[model samples]
Target: MATYPQEITLKVFVNKTKNCVDFVESDLDFVDVLLSFLTLRASLKCECGGDINTSVSYDLNRDDVNYEEFRGVFIKGAKFVVTDALCISLVEDLISTLNKCVNGDRNHMEVRLVKIKREQVLRILKRSLISDTPLTDVLLQNGEGITPKFSDSLAGKKVEKKVIDKEKKVCKLNMVLTRNKVLYAVASQDFVDLIFSFLTFPLGSLKKHLGSRFRMGCLNNLYGSAERLRSSGYMTAGCAERLLNPKLAPYFNCKNQVIGVEEEKEDLYYTCNGFCKLTALYFSCKSHGYSPYHESNQVTLVDPKSQLGGTISSHGSYCQKLMYMVTDELVVTPLSLESVVSFHNEIADPIKTAELSVTEAEILDVLAVALTSNTALTDAFLGTTVGVFTSVDVKGE
Candidate 1:
């Protein structure tokens, strides 16, 4: 009656003698065929078979399902149950092979097995019936679910807790004082300005903004307080060289020098003992037994070395020479003028130099008119002097 005469067939038997029959099929359905084969051939023999009893052995030939060769056929949803069961065993073997790969025993045979198993699993999932379902869902329902290994989970949690505890510990100071010792060497105005600005700000504010240890380190290195007033153009090499000397207090007047107009004059002088060492010399002719208010008399100079090398006629030539030596020996080389000029020129606009030109005669005429009138020139050069003064002393010989 059927056109295709049931070409595929399967037979099931109860015993190894091939005498007893359990099931038989002519038009072999894929799942039925697999069940019949597994039960009859792949299954082991039993003396008293009720439902293929406990005493069973694996039939290698019949049990060996080449998943790669039949992956497409199994994935069509026609033999879903049998295909899934076969796939579970295949995946387990593949996972074992993968473990071997991780342990540095990556054999070609194991690699091929894993590849075949992966292809079969993918193929089965891609079939029309299973395509709509998630791979995770299928694995969870049929294969091993997403349960984590206890040892691995515990190790991970310990590592995470350790990391969190480390993060919770209080922060430690990690900065070094690089600029402290070097500040005296840097005498530029801009450099001094930067340092002074830092010092002038409140320590609490600085600590709050820049950190406590950093501010303390900077202050310790700076040495002097921020309240000290600096000299004009103090960033020059000369000023920087002087900063190395210690402070010195000058001597005052003796009893004889305290009378009349001499009382109004105060003797204040500075001495250089070397780097960052300065002393002020005070003299009083009235108290120290010296002559008062006399130009030619020797008043006994107390701090002759404090003069920083200027002529002292009252103290004679010998004292002058001694003072000069001390100052010269303590002198340090300042930053050169040429370097500052070069830096200034580098920052200035080249185009401004190219802009305007004026003749000397025109400048002189403009200045002459500016001096005589309260006109445009007066507004331009109101507080400024423009020319040099030449004095001619007439001497009759």
Candidate 2:
């Protein structure tokens, strides 16, 4: 069973002069809560925040993630501050004003500890997809509201088919279209693998791909602030670059990945002649900490999930070879005649059959639609919604 504390406390730095939050200081647990918002496949929830069930609905597979596994996802024992570029600038201004103050007045700032509940966490998760100021809307404003409707520009636009060159790879999909909306699609393992890969994508990586159109609540503004800080030399080393374009962790990349995002490769390391482990950058003896260590030959690690313990033929297929039926809302299951019939019974319009040969670009479009709209299949193909089917042409052997 899924479990979390009823409430977690945070110390927020409020600027009394501006009547806004200057920054927030919290332990790793609060950071963990923030990070959890990114990993969720939350499109399943109603945009109005009505149908959200935090315990089981967010977990794609109903498995309860234990504390040890959760710890591995983020670094522990670290106290971090959450603030944007604007807040940083405000702090700098405040410091300058204080330095020149005649009375040594420090009454403009105050810190207060606030309790955030599980319901608020859910609100933040939901608002992340809709509002750009989710923290302000939920924390400071104390409102559980959401922008349920997308922009009008996205709804009525026509989806033009991009011409594919001869060398471009494609995934073949059989779509059931009716009244200008895609009812469902019959996709093979290749396409199924692509959709399943969505779970592994980081929020920053998604922002990198989607650009200004990413529009996942405060995350867009957050990523943009990070970019400005990086350009202005406010960020140290490669921290900004890593945050802006994070690569997937090792072994998480799919073999048939259509998206152009990079993934971390399994690195081979060597030990010294003294049998001390060594990395490419740092060479320290395990016994004598920080001591110089000579490099030996590289040692290869076996793929844990591979068959026969050799080079894995396939690295990331979560399911077996089977035709899958994907609904517009992204409910994926094995394709069956019975399931198709049940779906067919939901509509009463004249249906049309079309085989969509989609390339990498179209697959990315599908990803974008899945994130932004509930009618993913329809928007990816037809770019609009309409009534359902009356007559159907069911294909068979």
Q: Over all chains combined, what TM-score does candidate 1 have?
A: 0.12
Model 1 lDDT at residue 376: 18
Q: Local distance difference test, per candidate?
A: 0.23, 0.60
lDDT by residue for model 1 (205-295), tens: 2223222122122221222211121222212233322222211122221111111111113344432222122224332233333333321
Candidate 1: worst 10 consecutive residues by lDDT? 175-184
- The residue-by-residue lDDT of candidate 2 on 40-99, one tens digit each, is 333334343433344322221212444333431223323445652111222343455435
In model 2, which range of ten residues has the least summed lDDT?
84-93
Off by over 4 Å in 1: 1-299, 302-310, 313-338, 350-397
Cα shift from native, residue 208, model 2 (Å): 1.4
Clashes of 2: 6
Off by over 4 Å in 2: 1-126, 140-153, 157-167, 265-310, 383-397
